[model samples]
Target: MKNLAESVNIEAAEIMKIFQWKGTTDQLTDEEKTHLKYEIADTLIYLFYMCDQLKIDPVDVMKAKLEYNKGRHWKKDKE
Candidate 1:
């Protein structure tokens, strides 16, 4: 699909392929790590493409989003 949103979902699905039926995905296995890395790069490529298409600065938007997230109450690790 030419839709950027669709492209994002497709790329995300590709990334998720490595994690399918896998447990403790937070700790990716060596093999899965490699595959995930490539998929993540693919996703980022599409993301950058979308940014260019929209005439938006990805870095600036990311920084602003991070700053907005900083004010959320989601901090503190489970102890």
Candidate 2:
């Protein structure tokens, strides 16, 4: 779980680069874009490995969560 969480954190940091740039991902350099791609892949790899160890189907769980979320009422933040 720790490894999976850490990988997600690293991916989040990479994603934040887009917001930090004050523009879209296209504003990032080619190398930065590739690095973000790798970070996302690393997070997915960790998630799948953890799910495999627990004998869980990642896709099934994700589908279930999506269904659950569909029933949820989210309050939009005041702008």
Candidate 3:
């Protein structure tokens, strides 16, 4: 679980760099793109490992969450 959390945090940081270091991810260098890809893969790997350890089906959880979100409304940030 700790690893899963850490992986998510790392992934978030990598994504933040896209917005903070550059205007968008579209202009990321090849190395930066590769780094981001690996970070995302690491997050998914940790997530799946944790799910397996807990005997959880991530697909089912995501499906349920998607359905639950359908009834919720999000306010757009004032830009």
CA lDDT scores, all candidates in order: 0.85, 0.77, 0.79
Per-residue lDDT tens digits of candidate 2, residues 1-79? Answer: 7877787677777677645746543466787788778877877887788898789999999999999998877786332
Regarding lDDT, does 1 or 3 come out ahead? Answer: 1
Tens-digit lDDT string for candidate 3 (1-79)? 7877787777777677655746544587788788778877877887788899889999999999999998877776433
Tens-digit lDDT track of model 1 for 5-56: 7888888999888888777836778988888888899888889989999899
The candidate, 2 or 3, that scores higher on lDDT is 3
Off by over 4 Å in 3: 24-26, 77-79
Query: Which residues of candidate 2, in runs, are more than 4 Å off?
Result: 1-26, 77-79
Indicate the TM-score of model 1. Answer: 0.78
Q: Which residue pairs show backbone clashes in model 1?
A: none
Q: Top model by TM-score, which number?
A: 1
Q: Clashes in candidate 2: how many? A: 0
Q: Considering TM-score, where higher is better, how would the candidates rank from best to worst?
A: 1, 3, 2
Best prediction by lDDT: 1
